[model samples]
Target chain A: MTTTQVAPAPPGTGTDRPAVAVRGLVKRYGGRAVLDGLDLDVRRGECFALLGPNGAGKTTAIEILEGVRRRDAGEVLVLGEDPSLAGRGWRDRVGVVSQGEGAGQALSVRETLDHFARYHARARSTEDLLAAVGLQESAGSRVGRLSGGQRRRLAVALGVQGRPELLFLDEPTTGMDPVARRQFWELIRGLRADGTTVLLTTHYLDEAAELADRVGVVAGGRLVEVAPPEELGAALRRETTVSWLEGGARRSVRTQAPAAVLRDLLAVQAEIPGLSVTRPGLEDVYLRLVGATPTTSEGALR
Target chain B: MTALHATPAEPRGLERLRWAVADAVAAAGRDVAHWRRQPAAVLVAALFPVLLLLMFTYLLGGGMVVPGGGDYRDFLVPGMLALAMVFGVEATMTAVVTDTARGITDRFRSLPMAPSAVVAGRCLADLAGSVVGLAVLLAAALAVGWRPGGLVPALAAVGLLLLLRLAFLWMGIYLGLLARDPSMVVAVQILVWPFAFLSNAFVAASSMPGWLATIAEWNPVAGTVTAVRELFGAPVGTGGGWATEHALLLAVAWPVLLTGVFAVLSVRRFQGLSR
Candidate 1:
């Protein structure tokens, strides 16, 4: 039964049909709501990043959208079909790089990708996929023998081998080194350019800022805010910090306009030594947005 | 790349069946690859029963008496074959449990392949290994002066042994799915040894205490062992009860019943897996 619980449409779910849409999604575990009446929409050809702290239902929400999980109540549509009712065709259209390392340990890299490729009607060539993930040299290496980052890359290669129209990446770069993470970002960029809709969840603020077309801040079992990363950063707090050294003391002022404060300071003196102006970064805003609850603390960021 | 973007329609009827068979075959190949990668482990598992056959036939056969006054080696050979069938449960259990705990099972579930393919493949590979193990054990039995009665009955005995293996395979799958860790395979192994010994696999049920004899005679392993011994014309008329008297009937029925109960349970457990 595809229970299309007609929730009031989310803002800006305009004419272009979303690749994924969920309405009033409620999932309960042991009578506690992991996802409580959450609504989300990811537009076609856009990177939608879902951000939340640990145990905030990001993985649960992703699994439901991927059609591998059942929601207690709500409407969910992935690729225009209810995920619960979706079949192999729907599965073909979606690729999931889950948080856990799901690769078969005994299979070599190329063999693993080749095995998964057969499940899809059409799949990218193993050579191309291996090269894309920079794993061509390790194609003969067993999955268990690969380093953590290499295994993650192999997983991504498997995820994209089918050339899915929609992709779900759950912490895809969790164990990647900086260089590998950047390489993975390039792969994501390439996928996005090819018009694959992506819904990603990650704890990394910079990943969301670097890749997301729009970012959603999930807190208290719901998305409290969804917007582009810059707008999200700005909307949470507009205050800018202007700091300068004066008479052997450091003075800092928070204001809406750093330029005005700098001008005022310049009017009184020739120049302010060690002067700098900065706005709250994505990490700071994310912390304040999802960290407003009682349990939110400095350790939450860590 | 453009062609790859298109989603294939859901397979229908014969196409779906074909895909399911192909998926299962591929899944079986995966397990075969595991065996190939670990040839030593596979060799040991396959040959362990032969070692036991030698130990019992030579070391312990001196003190044993056959019910019908025949060589105990002939009697012990077929019994060991049945015991070998029963022993495969541990291998199947460990493989299934490790797959579940390692996330490979979940990965298979998430794929577009047929839902039944994974278990079907596992059954295929395990049964194939059991067949090989039987062949090796039987060859060793022949080398040690055990002669078969007829080709047809010997083949029938082998069939019963395989059927027993298939029945235990389902039980193994169910237990593996129920276990939370691969360490539970040890518990299964420990329990299986006692279960095997308590049956007529290594001793005559008639020699046990009255109540123990009844339990041993009724054991599924005992049924297969007794049935195969009759088919191979090694020993017979070791009366324990009506069930023991009708060994062949019970042998067939035991496997069918075990497969029915445990297959249902394994399927239910598989379908209930949310992770």
Candidate 2:
């Protein structure tokens, strides 16, 4: 009997070790340090997002990891090889959809995808890629004629043609409409399901919450905090606020188990006054963390 | 679509070379498709030189005089061919700078293609367009009763013109990489017209006054134009100077030197760009 797995898993892949690993990475421009000793790790088959404000070193860090830019000092590894020294073999296993990047404007969308497709020995068919990115209707139009969001989707389409094990998407949905963003999320989900490890950089809070397995809040050239979207920050995350009236007095208590408290309260009486369960949402904690860290200097210097 | 990559390891031997060639060809083919998609732009680009050629032949031909006895049209044809080669240099630089500005250059550098493929592709694409432009100008010259003489010499003249173009493209690549923004290109574009006209590309260099004539003779464009004129059996610029007298030698030497210098500068610039 033959098993059907469309993606041919490369050797030495599917390991327990993280897909991306960086330790004390340092990069500077002029005299100012843009990335001052940043550390990060992205697990295999997980979507890790570096969420930050403008000039939080998110783009610089990602660029260094992608090997488009070099670091001043420190150890960095992607797929078990130092990115700066990695060869074409490493490139074959990694895909990049860089911000502000687009193929030739003079060429049609299909032609643009086809040109990039030729670089990969085993590439997705242009038809499948066009359909996947929802650009089939505009496949015949010149890249210059496409809208900004349409062009971005084409960039995403080109990035995934090689079926890379590790995909780097830098602000991939920055300009997409709500509907297009939803569609793009589905495409990323498909890649995640197929075991692709993704590293994304975005300032869009919802985009990060909707996709990232874990989000790292970067500021002051460092990751101030990192956790899953639902548990990003704050001591209040695990605690639920249980408020009610005890006898004639208004009372409130924060505890890990609101259900147990509610059951006990119901046993005491038929109804509890001002009964409400409240917990700190991811947005509340995120604003508190990112807003508190200083990232303004990086953008100003750049 | 099935295999993640062609090989688990870095492609060795023939596989590497095959893909390298494929990447360069694919990159070049992108430009070809661009022309096919926008025939109007291609037509305008191809016709601009022909318009200049026709205008000079009819408009200015009657009033002009070659130092040696020859029809002005005959002299202008070869000069224009060499000058037209300089025109494509700006296009190459614009392409390079635009790519850099759009982050397209960075994207290409991140790919798994051969190191030289990007430059090679641009050269191939520009060279392809240059050849077509040359052919159109030659046809226009023939229609205007200007003969470029025998096959052997004509082909050699075409070779020198293309060599001049190759030299300029390397310079374009270096400058374009440095500019990185389309807005910065206007200064160079404005300067190109004066640079082209200051040579013997339009009127004979000897026709200008003493010091100016000497400068025109030594102009790199003048050397190629004069050499091409000699090859086409037209009147060569008779200015008395080392560069003027040594047309054929300077024709080959200037381009070879320019190509060597700019290619090195451009490659070094590109290597340092990502950092």
Candidate 3:
């Protein structure tokens, strides 16, 4: 297959450019390339979702951007600075909410947040952070004693307490229940409203659809596609599936234009029973982009 | 949300160092708080060495003989101090392993604090725990008539024992980072027992076989034991053996060398952890 290459731009795009930029980023473990020359751009104040299966190098890419892991080859910039060489001031502007529960099991929720607040010069107050995460009722409870959802909320609160310009949330809602997940999404939206650029990785397609302004689908150590949710399902737009029952018999038709097909169906009968028209969802488009069996491995992390 | 607060007044060099030290102190405070919540674990760890000292000094002291003429408790006390330092390694190992398992180390990595605070905090907290253990053991030893020759020598003996503890702290940090599982700390603990026993902790090297005696005299634990003995004015063998002749030097050298090797290895391991 022929690969088209884009020309590189001159240095210093602008002070008000994207919050994060990655060009030709490559990472390898032993001989296996986890990230095969990836490129990504996350604009300021946008909630960008990175969708990938397990082992698709999503975590590796995020860690490199967070300055926790080094990339073998890349021109990566986070918050207008090279992440690999970013200093402590750069680190202070970036907050990371990782996959696991945080430390300080014995520390109470308020105390844990209070301790972390000291590490940052412009951290939010502990009480306000607790209320934001909906953990005010459990402020005095030890972190070890809280439920998994509460712990994850506390983790998110800690991540944002420093008032970072950029925040990376890696599987942030992994253990949250439906209500908690909705609540967390509101909290993320709040952050975006406050001009915090959020780069999120999640297995939940619904979550990405609800929170992300744009989504990037990664598979086989490569970003296969990136676009808005509505545009991503465009592949399935050419063919529409219509299902209905006529004369007690089930009937279905696939057509390029659903409007034309509906007109024809109406001409055949005055009214059709149990009629329904369906278009592919973001999950369908995502699975097709990643080239996997949509039923079995729709959101499986590669 | 609050307008970024005017860049927050960048800290100076000394201020940064002070922040790092404060971070370590806060982490150590967290560990102390955990100990307070689980007092049983601390009690067991702190009192075990003291109980062993009592059992040995009273039950086994009468039968044991030093190379030079002296009461067994006087000889036993210095060795016990060295034993206490060795014994404390398990606590350090366990604490490090537990922190790793609980994702505490990963949490520390994500924070924007000083990089060395995690291990440094651990060493400081473990040192505090060891000091408590040393004090209890010393009290038990004193109760059993284990007296130093003078006040100055007793203080010197304590200073040497603390030095040995500091050395062991680094060793423990290295081992803790190297071990993958908390259960591996048990294996490390078991390994420490042989190193302690093979030294001149429980008996005189001269009373053992010639080959074993040679090994014991050269053992790093033996160096600390001999140095503490000299500090406490305990009996040093009349013969110009290797341990008595170079007691002070070996005491300092053993800790320095062990700490150097382990400290370098620990820092390397810590860097490798990001991988």
Candidate 4:
């Protein structure tokens, strides 16, 4: 019940410490361990994205850290205190935007936001929140009547209104339109620019790549890989696959030197059919890391 | 606004009480806020007990009798008030189950707001609504020519009704947390009817068979009904049991006991929801 753990420095104090630290987090449902001894550390003032497939314990792990769900065994420190045992002061510094709809349907959009804002000693004004989240027009609309995207934006607004020291966002942009998604990214970027610590879990790799300082891929209840988006699957990224037509059959070679392979193929034939070099992007590296067969447009071209 | 990421420790004593009251008011205000957008729904819920009062008083009243000789209206009116208090429980359960099911309860829990704020707020809000419903039913009772005893006793009767309501509010809240799904509450709502009829809220328990009378007399609703009938100077039939003999005491004890039991159960269930 008690363990020595470093607490995150006060916001805007400019210290480098893990805003969230998890050690041996174990959660079981009906004798099946959803989170099997997962360990992770997300540093302060950075956006860390957790990527995983469905039922990979990403949600379970996030809820545990948020203090919404309990863990069988784990040492968790969010802003330096155990989430499950954390009290009001802990909740004050932590902001959570859980997945799915939780806003009261009876209240108007503005009213819903106002109600949550009262819980915080400091909070953004309702006008600013509505304007920032682009819900200004629907401010008077019932929460239940708003579109899915609008509701998601409202959730995001509620999460950040407290100007939390640590923010937990679970699939924040699931139902957002392209413009809304872009706007959401900008909003997050603004928060990060303020030295806020954000932990995001999302299915969209591009979203992870676009926003994450580092992305951690989780599978089977543990981190498969955690690295900067560019540095993720470096070995996989370094290898290039060259595919073309040979003897009326498609052929491909994965190699460190694709230029030499292309030149040698051209030396054999005046014009190489389907001669293309493909480097695995974040998606490919992610797909392969999660044990999915990474495919490229060239594969579908054939 | 003064930002409080600076205060690592929570405030103590009076400050904590201030937060508790403020948070409870805010959460309770949320329920009242719902009434603004859905006035019709609120009106219907308030008037529902009045409908039952008319039905039982006019249609069912002719066949009913008080054992010791009094107007059937006198006996039936007190019982109807208790019945009305029990009936409002459906509203309490539905609101709670819907709130918990839709994830608002989780959201409430996640906030830094006072720990007991949501529940106390719900208690305040529901009890306030019950007060309004009670007023409406009382107005209907007066319109129907059902007279009662002195104002002081009548006030005591009203207190008993509200106390019974407070107890059921916890009971409903407990059941709602247990179910966590609004659909499951439908079964409970259906079950309330048989529960209401089984109490002496309708006929005098003395008229039933010996065993049935004992069971009905012991029903909490019957305890409240019988106590209020005494308070209103109505015929409280001759029944030979500890429950009937001490109606006023049982009336107070039953609700207080139920409130303690269910409040603990509801809060514990809410805290363990993650498990």
Against the true structure, whose lDDT is highest? 4
- DockQ (Cα-based) per candidate? 0.37, 0.42, 0.35, 0.49
Cα shift from native, residue A94, model 2 (Å): 0.5
Query: Model 4: how far is B120 from its true place, Å?
Result: 1.4
lDDT of 1 by residue, A132-159 (tens): 8899899999888999899889878878
lDDT of candidate 2 over B60-117, digit per residue (tens): 7788888767788888998889878887778889889988887788888778777678
In model 1, what is the error at residue A3, expressed in angstroms? 26
Give the runs in model 3 whose Cα sits over 4 Å from its true position.
Answer: A1-15, A242-277, A294-302, B1-12, B237-240
Scoring only the A-chain of each prediction against the true A-chain gives TM-scores of 0.84, 0.79, 0.83, 0.89
Pairs that collide, model 2: none
Query: What TM-scores do the predictions have?
Result: 0.90, 0.87, 0.88, 0.93
Chain B TM, cand. 1: 0.95
lDDT for each of the candidates? 0.84, 0.83, 0.80, 0.85
Q: Best to worst by TM-score, what's the order?
A: 4, 1, 3, 2
lDDT by residue (tens digit), candidate 3, B1-275: 12232123334479768978988987888788888878998888878887778877778877877766887788888888888888877788777777877777877876767777888888788888877888888888888777777888778877778788888888888888888688898788778878888878888877778888888888888887888888788876544366657978888898888889999999998888766
What C-alpha lDDT does candidate 4 achieve relative to the native structure?
Answer: 0.85
How many angstroms is residue A231 displaced in model 3 relative to the true structure, after the best TM-score fit? 2.4
Q: Across residues B133-225, which tens digit of lDDT does each residue of candidate 1 receive?
A: 999998999999899999999999999999999999999999999995989998888998879888887778888899998888999888888
Using TM-score, give the best candidate's number.
Answer: 4
Candidate 2 residue lDDT tens string, A113-134 = 8888877757889999998889
Candidate 4 deviant stretches above 4 angstroms: A1-15, A246-251, A259-271, A294-302, B1-8
Better of 2 and 4 by TM-score: 4
Q: Candidate 3, TM-score vs. the true structure?
A: 0.88
By DockQ thresholds, what CAPRI class is model 3? Answer: acceptable
